[model samples]
Target chain A: DVKVTQSSRYLVKRTGEKVFLECVQDMDHENMFWYRQDPGLGLRLIYFSYDVKMKEKGDIPEGYSVSREKKERFSLILESASTNQTSMYLCASSLWILAGGPGEQYFGPGTRLTVT
Target chain B: SQELEQSPQSLIVQEGKNLTINCTSSKTLYGLYWYKQKYGEGLIFLMMLQKGGEEKSHEKITAKLDEKKQQSSLHITASQPSHAGIYLCGADKGYGNKLVFGAGTILRVKS
Candidate 1:
């Protein structure tokens, strides 16, 4: 079975503070994604990495950045955490099979971040 | 407008009842996925449908992709309390492995 683990399940930070959310996958997938889920708004993509050091912005990438220094690890960074940034952050990883299309994404338990 | 739309934002059903949830897309879907998420938890993949007129079942849950490939439905038979959760449908956006998801359908099973 595939396993995706997050560094933290819950976090609290003050306004203007820097925050980091980490995700690691054991399946050696090539694609990693970061998403924020909100009520009524649903899950909106924040950023994604296709390969090491290669990143792409999604629909909502403002106020957030991502790092993929290694294949198993992906990190989400908040430049300056604000109250509006508080959300349930989720990380997912998938394999890119050119012949068969992208595989299903496996998601971590998610981290609920609270900005005060 | 939303690219993917899910009907009946929420549903309340009694145990042993049957219910169906629908997902419609404005564009043709290359791949459609069904997932269930418990409150404050991550999504658990239920099924994936790729071809038109495809149907897959797991236990009491069945999912079908219409012949047009623009719509899908999930039906649960003999629903139980364990079935209560948020159901979300997602589809590929045609590039970069990006997926667009619906707002989700909240299910509450009354025992």
Candidate 2:
């Protein structure tokens, strides 16, 4: 079975503090994604990586960045966190076939971040 | 541009009753996926539909995608207590890293 594990489940940070969220997948998948889920906004993609050192910006990518130094690990970085950034962060991984085919993105337990 | 929209933010029904959730999109969807998210947990994928006017079923649940490619429905036959959760519908143009999700439908099935 494919397993996607996150570094933390609950995190509390002060305003302007830097934070990092880590995600690792053992399925050897080629695509990794980061999304922040809000009540009414649903799940909005923050960043995604297809290969090592390759990253793409999603719809909401402000004040956040991602690093994909290895094939199995992806890290999301918040240079300066704010209260408005408090939300549930989810990491997902999926296998990329030859073309843009339908793939199930498996998600982790998610990390609930609270900034005060 | 808000690609997906789900109706009936919340619903409550008795066990054994049937329920349907709707998802509408502003743009044509190349694919649609249904997922269930429990409280304070991750999402579990239920089904995916690619072709328009297509229907798929699993156990007591059935999903249908309209031919117009703008709307989809998830029908649960004889709702059970275990089926209670936030049902989220998502769509994408092709199958890349990007997907837009709906706000989700919160369902509570009473026993």
Candidate 3:
């Protein structure tokens, strides 16, 4: 079984504070992603990394950045947290491709961030 | 850009009942995935369908991809309280690893 773990399960921060969410996977997957889930809006991609030092912006990447210094770890950074940034953050990891098809993503338990 | 639309934004069903959720895509889907998320929790993958006219089942849940590969349905039989959660459909955004997801359908099972 694949295991994805997040650094924090819940966090609280004041406005304009810097925040970091970390994710680590034991499967040695090559792809990792960060997403934010909000009520009614669903889960939206924030950023993704395909390899070490490689990153790409998703549909909603504003105010957020990501780091992939190593294969097993991915970090999401908020330049300056705002109240509107309060939401559940999820991290996922997957193999680039396995057996001629895309691999299914395994997700961590998620971190619920509250910005006040 | 590809978009996925999930029908019946929410559903309420009695235990032992059967229900189905549909996911339609604006463009042909190279890969479609079904996931269930408990409230305030991360998503758990249910199934993945790639071929046009393909179906896969796990326990009491079954998922099928339409012939055109633009639509998919998830059906659950003998529903239980444990089945209550948010169901989401995701598709590859033409890129192998990138995905676009639907708004999700909320399910509430009544005993």
Two-chain DockQ for each candidate model = 0.66, 0.67, 0.65
Q: What is the interface RMSD of candidate 1, in Å?
A: 1.1
TM-score, candidate 1, is 0.97
TM-score of chain B of each: 0.97, 0.95, 0.98
In angstroms, give how far residue B40 of model 3 lies from its true place: 1.4
Higher-ranked by TM-score: 1 or 2: 1
Q: List model 3 lDDT by residue over A1-116, tens digit each.
A: 78999999999999999999999999999999999998777789999898999998988999999999999999999999999999999999999963445678899999999999
**For model 1, what is the error of residue A62's alpha carbon versus the real structure, in angstroms, after optimal superposition?**
0.3
Q: Once superposed on the true structure, which residue ranges of model 1 sit more than 4 Å away at CA?
A: none
Clashing pairs in 1: none
| Model 3 steric clash pairs | none
Poorest 10 consecutive residues of model 1 chain B by lDDT? B1-10
Q: Candidate 3: list runs displaced more than 4 Å.
A: A98-101
User: What is candidate 2's lDDT per residue for A38-98, written digit by digit as tens?
Assistant: 9988899999898999998988999999999999999999999999999999999988755
Fnat, 2 decimals, each candidate: 0.36, 0.60, 0.52
Error of 1 at B74 (Å): 0.5
Give a tens-digit lDDT track for model 1, residues A1-116. 88999999999999999999999999989999999999987789999899999999998999999999999999999999999999999999999766544578899999999999
TM-score of each model, in listed order: 0.97, 0.96, 0.96
True contacts kept of 1: 0.36
